[model samples]
Target: MKKLLLLLVAVIGLSSCNKDSQEPRPVVPEGEGQPISVSFTGEVEDDSPRALEGTVNGSPAGKLLSFRGKGDVYGWVYVVDKDGEFAKGYKKLKVSEDGRSLSYEGTVPTTRSGGGTIDNATAKVSIYIGLDASGVFTNKGFKSIENVGHASGSSLGDDFAILKSENNALTYVSRSISGKYHEYKASNGKLSFSMAGSLILIRFRNEFQSPSHKVLWRKISGVLIKVADGAPLTRDPAIIDQMRVMNLHIDKIKIAVKDGNTQLTGTNEPSSGFIDNSTRYPNGYFFNLAKTVSIPTNTNRGVNSPFDNRESVIAFYTPISKRVDGRAGELAAFSFRLQNEAHYKEERFEDGLFSMASHRSVTFRSELEEGRVHRALLNITYQHVEGGGKN
Candidate 1:
């Protein structure tokens, strides 16, 4: 009869909808933790400026090198709720021996009791460069971040505060630079994630060999990479697709300097070559003058370059994107200090924005001069099939 036909059609439609939705796979045995294995093996999009491989001032301008990407790559899995937000708990993945893969084995918590079936539930996976055991995530790749505890599956919004440690413990926490964002799925026990974003490495130094202080410790207070106009910088993989779809452009970035409170904006001036010069940046950006290192006489590396002292390199990681400048490239920002200025502890900084066409070494003076990949990235470089070949 007509009534029977209508009921059958409704049942079929409901089944079809369930099939299309991101529902959890059939549950495994109660105690058998769902095995979630994540592997990272893919080429990140390269938009750094090109460099000619030749001699520069009688020295090799370009040297072949690899990329030993800073920090340990991490994988985080989050459970999603029906409202399209992070729910329940998340698992911190373990890195493989080769550093290309991350894995986690545990029951996907779907109930308050901590042990329940994931059937009909949703899962999201996110992969990122660097590791932070601290519950919160920051932008200073391989550097210390705000000491805070954010439980798994917590909703992170656009404006998150990074707190400074009150103690004098110089504990260093890794900042996650480029992240693969979030990938959602109704799982079947196994999951895989790939990373294809760009990396931003920011290094620091004292341009002068001598300053007026005993320990002219120049430090980068913080680093921020904004991808969209209204996206939350979160580790939850479930909402990555939403943020990515919102916008993949670099809206703004802020890198707080040590104490000068300087803001450097990029300019087309020919004199803007690298050294902290004022004339090059007519945009009214503050440049730390006093072009000499201000450290203890005996502790000074004495050499003008930071590379001479292995401790001078302060690396960072940031997501890659089609730059807002229309060239569709990656952007980077830097924070610096000259006298152990505690800008980070005070949180007194104004974010700045800038772009780099060429993705070269940030602070390795010899490597920058020779155009070689810094030793930090020696094991992770790849030759992008663009203009010529670039890392």
Candidate 2:
């Protein structure tokens, strides 16, 4: 009886200690993009759009949490700190409209982080990019970039654009604008108007170490693209209105020299027209020539078109000054192939222009010196952006 009484007293003491302890809650691990569990308050699988709710793993001991969305509704659901560049990838979640459940072939945010081509049923999703007390969305700075916002979609589209920003060229496009644009700011980066609706923030990525694109091209000549000489010249003062001429302004071009140095150059004059050498624009004026064919400046030397297309381009551009070749006279006349990828398109204005995110990525190869003027001879290949193969 004495031993039983002692055991009961010990049990009561243990119960009292247990009653004083606080309950522990499950949490997301730090650094890793582990899932943060939260209750989905409503019918998430219904046909109508629905917001998926969840708590970001607890941060800072007593920190408040915040959230937002990145990428399209169909892309990975990103987990990040409230303010910073977006994370590498996101969580792969199953979204459904009719309950068929559409998802990537493989769980992304693991296998791939960007350039996702969606061609299935429309995926409507809304993710809350939550922030913690420290004013960050994730403990890591992945989602902590400035100007945090949400990204959503009403359809599963093949083309997507990434937002771009820079010093002067309007780097900030509203993510709320339902489009994406890739900001090519490299020295030899190419810019395409196909991304018209989307923004292309161009800068001398080397600008941090080098001069601005403006300062770099200050001394260099712009492009001189030539289409069919037979194109009827227009008397209009606007160079763009002459789209009937089957030509466009050589905006920017990216080229890699046979010696293996990549150079990015652009137009002192934004667009060119039927005006040839006769029309005085600047030291870098593009004139429509009779037979001579050359690609525009800075384009991927290997991926432009032949000079024979009804719409061919020619430009006289000099790369930014380099230690090897300072701002000096033209280099030795050598030939390189220009496979034209971009096309001569005539678009109508006044209406909201078509929104497109142009990949327009290209490759190049060195060609032999042809004659008096040796240059790259690019075999214009049709812009085949879908098949994952060249045309």
Candidate 3:
């Protein structure tokens, strides 16, 4: 009986020792080194157009969120260690069918770039959205990404153009992960992104008065806008009319991403002269209207208002400089082609003086802001003389 009790006690002690010596199953604390979940929670500007409400390829209209073609939206996630070296390579984020979420296919690194385990408290995760495959490879090696606009010879790509249909206009966004590891890990590693740029809405209006019954406002053939300085130019001595009008468009915009922050540079391309280099406007960059806008003739009403027709143009991701002077600076100059119908009682008025195409320009001191609509009223008024008015 004594030997049996001793043997039983020894067996129990051995079993208890084994259970205590186990590695505790190495608890992973949930979401440790797991793939991240990315979702588009929408943009900061509420009133502005939503970025995801556009179609790509044959995808459903206003349902696809991509630029140029399908699967063009590439993502670069930087998992940096304490030494600022990349811990992982580029990961392609697959976009969900709903176009609302994106996810990485690979698992997050458990170790640092060098060798040791990643310091979740000190390490950082930076994410970049809206880059193409080419763009990603071109900028992958660098610690940061820099995009030079038209002025710097680097193209902003086809996706930057706002007028390229509702579905085609796209911009880039970036964000750096904040807070502690457990906080993000517990939430399943979801992130929200906002637009890194602004929108400029240019509302054009014809507020002109007719001097005589014979001359009537017909339509505006085209509109041109340029950045300028000094005081606004006069109607009679139109600066744009004196100089040859060159077809200029904003081809690119500047953007930079560093240390997890994104910014749009205010550098713009210089305007070229039509005749010679001497006529070149250094600070002037012109954008021509894609189409002509016609104004209806209201014979009874003397003034033509934009509220009647509501014709406007939208400039996407255009950068505006901060006002140096407390007052308004001559930020933009507008010129438009004015057409009119003139009739005299005697003849068909084929040779009428006012029948020729009229070109008028107006410069105003106004400030342009981002994510807001700026209304520019081009007042087309005619002052008739007793003999013959100037064209």
Candidate 4:
């Protein structure tokens, strides 16, 4: 019996030793494709391609992939997988002077007896970038990314290389830590991305301008209301809600042209107000409308000042999808009309009617646009000139 117990102990120790011998190697359970998140950042030296030099960090096979994001006129991304993920350091990549690209190389892992099979796949990428008339990087709402092909090798983590096209620019591709990224494109189409922890999709957009790039229409008005005592300007529920919906802030609004060029595109700081948006679409356009109607005063309502019952709703139709930024020269021909009507009780004032209309054919330049609701906000402008009231 003692001998039997001793034999069992020996066998158990050998089994434990064998189990502990296996290294920490990651394997994605058999699945067609697994989720991955990639992010990069860099600076641009010139204006041609959108790629720049930056650092890359992401979960590669559920482990952090460390590498450098190389830049050509266009940009390409390459990650170096050392023998172990926790191991430090990697290789650097660069491109030729002509704007053609470069790549990164790696080695794979193997098992005993050379029996296990794993794909040794390498990435080949091509890139294109567009901006808008505003000198802003407009990507409609997102950029387009395509992979030429991924060549597979014999074993897991085998030596592989990522190649770039001879003529293609290296466009930068990246995502946030949370894995949210925008892809601006010129054509209307749907896209799917393997986000960090989720599967995301881009729906096709159809519009002259993307809603993200579209402006909210509103009118800034200065009216004298019949408030007996102290009244909070925000007490007006409708007025408060308007502030939340539109980018309406009461400040001096100045309109100027880009270098006095009628056919100008983006607004130079001296000429236009800049609109802020995400990287999906970064360009904007400014066109002149032949119609600029002014309402002197509210003659229809029983009021003392120029502002009584006067309002304006700026309207605009935005593109259905996000266009590439820096491609702002693209425009949508739109017919816009500004309509205003003021009604006054006959007993309230001498004249009981006031109305104004403005219609014009304006082309809206939008490359960095998404088919969401663009802003077309109009500010209420109450002509504060004296005698403007219908006395």
Candidate 5:
């Protein structure tokens, strides 16, 4: 009886082992395209001394504008492998309700001919926002980022021009990914997109304290921006060579003001601000404004109040050069034109043009960085005349 029980236990153990071995194992399909999930996180770097407060129009200052509500926010995605670029398509990113994150879904090529899986395959993906499909890609389906904002015949313009509106300024961010085929399946990494350019904010402050020194602040008719020589505002190699010794001009800037504040409240202007690349101004562009911007006068309220109650500010969006060889970018020189040239002369000021570089007392040399707010304060203070009497 003991021998018989031992034989039966041995048979049961063998049977259990067989059953376990026969069970099916889970299998992942191979030799086919794989689904990929990519997430984008937008970031804006405010390099200004003081953080910007409130909003310009409805868009927050020093922040990426909301992309959800705008139907025009879209970009192209390109995927490349060892075999070169295989897939390129337009993708309209879905922005989160809060507008902080964006998401995209697509398939990554992973297989070869004859149902063979590509070994040691790598994938590279690139996404560019804030540009139209036709403007960003050529008819051959290749990316033509070199001539983004270039004039029809002019050789100069921003390679990746940022679109701006009274409501919001459109910014762009790009990201790339690369690894083995299977690694992409586990890759849900965050792609950070920063503001591809810089925001220039010029604040007008009236610092005249003495009643006798008070001068009438004239309406600003236009402003001129001359970027430093060798500033690489565009990506074209040929254009960069030509720009080495040339200054990029942004002239004929008409300002729009409401009440006493320099707020963008115009509706007749181009939503994306027109870029005039006339050859009359080489390596320069201009945008129109609805009305003239007037500067506020200093309030003579004893020692407590020195500035006016209203804020006079003008904003400009420009592309900044990337740092090369550890060198920082240069700040653009600014010159403002007054509506009444005689008013500036009457106050003993030099001409109607207020050049930021001409003032020696006010030293402002902020290194320019992409996606940062470069704030410049222009104080319309009165110069004390030797013979002029002051209370």
Candidate 6:
């Protein structure tokens, strides 16, 4: 019995020793090295044609959430580390089909030293809506991003235009993004955001004297505006009456190197000449104000106008500078004049006098409040002096 008991004791001791000698397994921390979930949420704050309704159009589609890629609406993210300039780079988050939501999930570099890891506090993000992810929109700051379209270009630094081109098919035509930057810092590994659009809404109507002796409002074609300093030019005394052009035309819009159109066609030639580069006026750029509206017949005119008595509203993402002393002052002095489509016709104006198209341009300056839609009402009456009031 004692021998058997001693043998059992020996066996148990050996087993315990074997277990103690074995190496311990490693342990892992919770929520480490996991992709962060990002979600987009929010509606644009805008002025609705109806004072109480807000923006008549719904929210925009295809919102872009970029980390540090190029200035484009869509591009690759280069880095994930926040400390390093190239650390946590660019990424194009996926916008939901409805455009009401945008979501992204990925691990960003945790450190500037080069290894990729997931981090909550270090990751930052920027948002863009109603702007091209491509490097197209020139003047609005889309090319400002470093290495946007070049071998080293990133397309991540340029400012985007507010116009929603066909490229942004997912986004609404009228909805635009407020050119503002946003930061991402989520503790629970989740990111959510809201964005608003800053647009200058100009509602205009064309009033013409009808045979009935009553002034009637109607829709006309070729509605465009020129970004010029101060009011529209009356009659330039310097230029001969034949060469005197009053309204700025699209083909005449000038674009300089700093303006960012130089790199577009890969050429350095002047963008546009007549009105764009003229020393006579401060017309900085030319943009088609709105899609060409079909002319309505005289009988088509009714008590009600299109879209709540609003003939057309030009939603402009003002690219004017904010500096009061600098370009801002120049822009503040700027006004948008309607082009006299007739003047461009193969036939010239009746006489030497310039036909005031859409009457005249009003001041284009307005307060830029985030999410606020600035409103301007311009009533254009065709002022036709019989026989073309010549100077």
Report lDDT (CA) for all predictions.
Answer: 0.23, 0.19, 0.28, 0.19, 0.31, 0.27
Q: 172-246, model 4: which lDDT tens digit per residue? A: 233334543221111112111110110001111111111111111222264333323222221111111111101
Decreasing TM-score order of the candidates: 5, 6, 3, 1, 4, 2
Per-residue CA lDDT of candidate 2, range 118-178, in tens? 2112211122211121212111100111111112101111111111111111122122222
> Model 6: residues >4 Å from true position, as ranges?
1-92, 96-98, 108-123, 129-185, 188-197, 212-278, 288-290, 294-310, 319-358, 364-366, 382-391
Candidate whose TM-score is highest = 5
Ranking of models by lDDT: 5, 3, 6, 1, 4, 2
Segments in model 2 whose C-alpha atoms lie over 4 Å from true places: 1-35, 38-74, 82-89, 98-157, 161-391
What TM-score does prediction 6 earn?
0.42
**Which residues of candidate 5, in runs, are more than 4 Å off?**
1-51, 58-64, 68-72, 81-86, 107-121, 136-188, 206-290, 299-310, 323-331, 347-367, 379-391
- For model 4, state the Cα shift of residue 36 in Å: 10
- lDDT per residue for candidate 1 within 1-391, as digits (tens), equals 0100000000000001111221222332323333322222322213111211221112122111111121222222334323332222233334344333334443333332333322233233332222122222332222211111111111111111111100011111222233312222323333323222222222222222222121111124543433323222221101000000111212123222222121112123222112322354222122232222222222322122222322222222222223223333332223333333221111111222221111122221111111111222211011212222111
Off by over 4 Å in 1: 1-75, 80-87, 92-100, 111-135, 140-199, 203-311, 319-335, 340-391
Q: Relative to the unseen true structure, what is the C-alpha lDDT of residue 192 in candidate 6, on a scale of 0 to 100?
A: 31
- Model 5 whole-model lDDT (C-alpha atoms): 0.31
Q: Quote each prediction's TM-score.
A: 0.27, 0.16, 0.42, 0.18, 0.45, 0.42
TM-score of 2: 0.16
**Using lDDT as the measure, which candidate wins?**
5
Residue 191, model 1: Cα distance from true site in angstroms? 5.4
10 residues in a row with least lDDT, candidate 1: 5-14
| Candidate 5 lDDT, 1-391, residue by residue in tens | 0100000000000001121321232322333454333333332222321223432223332121333233223554444444543333455555555444555654433333443432223544555554444423111100111111122111111222332211111121222355332323213245545443444444444443222221223234543233223212211101000010112222211223232222111122222333434364333334333334444345222211222223334444443332112224332343343443223323322223331111112212343454454544444443423333221
- lDDT per residue (tens digit) for residues 1-391 in model 6: 0100000000000001122221232221212232233323322222121221111222111011121211113322222323422222234445444333334444332223333432333433333332232322223310111211123222111232221100000111121134221233332333333222233334344443222221222223532232222323232111001111112111211212221111112122222222342466543443332233222212232212223322323433332213122444343222344344443211113233233434334443333443333444444444533344333
For each predicted model, how many residue pairs clash, with residues at least 3 apart or on different chains?
A: 28, 63, 0, 71, 0, 36
